[model samples]
Target: MRLPRPGEPRRQFVKRFLLLAAYSRVLTADWNGTLLAEIKPPKRPTFGMMRLRLSDFPALQNDFGSVRIGTSALTANNPLGLLYPILINRATQGQFYALLSECTHAGCAVRPYSKESGACVCPCHGSRYAIDGRRTAGPAFFPLLQYPIQFDGINTLSIELPDLPHEIEGSLVRTLPGAEFRLQLRFLAFAHLEYEVVFRASKTDDWRNVQFSLTPEAPLNRSFVSGADDYLNLYVEPAAGLGFFAVTIRILPV
Candidate 1:
C-alpha cells in the first residue's frame, strides 16, 4: 500500500511488496462481526496483439468519436484492462488511436473524452488529457501511455501491446462468530494459475493451508466481477480465538 522507497528499483520494490502482501493480515476486533480485507490484484497480462473491428464500436465510426473498452469486454486479449480508442481526423483523413486509460498523476482510470471539454478527465484528481492522450491540464505532467495501433483503412484495427506480468483483482470477506469463522474470496482465475487460501490464529502464528469450496460449483470464466466470477469459501467449524486469512497465487508452468 505504500509507495516504493527512494532509490529503490522498480522490480525490487514490486517483489518486496508482493512478498509482504501475501503475508499481511488484519488484526481481530473485539466483537464477533464481519471484517473486510482489501486485497490488491496484480496487473493484468498482455497477449501481445489484439484485433478489433471498428464496426463493433459505433462511436469510433466518426471523427472525434471515442469508446472505452474495459476488462469485461477484453477478456480474451486482456489489453491492459482499460483502454480508450479515439477517432482523430485531419481534414478528410481519419485514423484511430488507442490510449491506456490510467491517469499519469495517481493511476486512477480516466473517463472517456467529453465532447464539451474535448479532453479525458481523471475522476480522482481532475487530470485532463487531450484526445491524443497528451497532458492538457491539471496535476499530471506526463501523457498517457499510447499503444501502437494500425488501421487497415477499413473496419479492422490492430493494436500491439508490450508483454507484461499477469495478475487479477480480488477481495476477501470474513465473518467471525462465537466458535467458527468463514471467509469468502472472490477473484478472476486464469487457466495457467493456481490459488490457495491460508489461515492463522494470530499475527505471531504460522499460516496453514485451508480447504475451500467453490461457490458456483462449476468452472470459472475469464471476466472478473466483484460478486460474480468464482468464490472460494472456507469454513472453519471449531475455530478458536481471532482468525487471519490470506490468498496466495502461483503461476503454473506452461
Candidate 2:
C-alpha cells in the first residue's frame, strides 16, 4: 500500500486502497503474531490513554531492551492484524521510544531490536532501523512511524491514541433448517479494533458466548462488499424457535 501523499486526505487514501484490496484477487497471508493474553483497558472505555508500568517488563529496565504491546504477535509482514502492534524500546534511563512495527518498504513488521546489531531488522527485505526508528539501511527510505510517549521519569509510560468507536455497523441473517442454522454476519471493522460474538435465546435472556468452533473460520473479502466490512458465516445449533445475536467491538490497548 502506498503512503498518503503530502496534503492528501488520509481517510480518503485509506478508503481508496481498501477498495483496491477488495477487488484484488490475491489473498495476502496474515503475517502478524498470535494475539496476546487479554489485558483490561482503562475503567472509562472512552479514555484513549495507554499506561504501562516499566516494572512489568524486565527487558525495558535496560537500554536497547524492548517489548511489544497490542493484541497480535510481532512479525515481519503487515504489523497490522486485528490491531497494530506498538514496539516500545528503552533508549536510556527515563527515556523510551514507541514505534509502529510496520516496515515502510512493504508494510511488513520489523523484527524486535537485536542487541547484537543495535537495530531492528526487517526480515522481508533486510531494511534496518535505528533504536529511535530512523532508517539506517535501505530498500526502505522512510523511517518507521513513531508515536509520542510521556514518561514520568520513573516507572510509568503513557501513550495516547485516537478515541475509539463504541459501536459497529452490521446486519445478521439466519438460514438453514432442521438440526442446525447458519448465521451470516456482516460488519464494518476498523483495523484497530477487536470483536466478539455473543448470542441469546430471546429478549429476556442474558447474552452468552458462543463456542469457538461456531465462529467464522475465514473472513469473506469480495468486490461487492464495502472495503471496511467483514463477512462471517457462523454455524449454530438451534435451541428452539428463535435466537438473537450480536457482535461486540473494542479497541485494543497500545
User: Model 2: how far is 241 from its true place, Å?
Assistant: 34
Candidate 2 lDDT, tens digit per residue, 180-239? 333344445544345555557776676675542334333322212112335433333334
If candidate 2 were superposed on the true structure by all CA atoms, what would the RMSD be?
13.4
> What is the C-alpha lDDT profile of model 1 across 1-254, one tens digit per residue?
12223244434322111111111011221111111122233234433445565664555566666555432222222222233222221112566667777778877767666666788788777999888889999999899888777788888766655442222222222342332223234334333335555567775676676666554232322222222334333332224445655545432211
State the C-alpha lDDT per candidate.
0.46, 0.52
- Residue 137 alpha-carbon offset, candidate 1, angstroms: 0.4
TM-score, every prediction: 0.43, 0.49
The predictions' CA RMSDs to the true structure, in order, are 18.2, 13.4
Off by over 4 Å in 1: 1-47, 72-92, 163-254
- The residue pairs in collision within model 1 are none
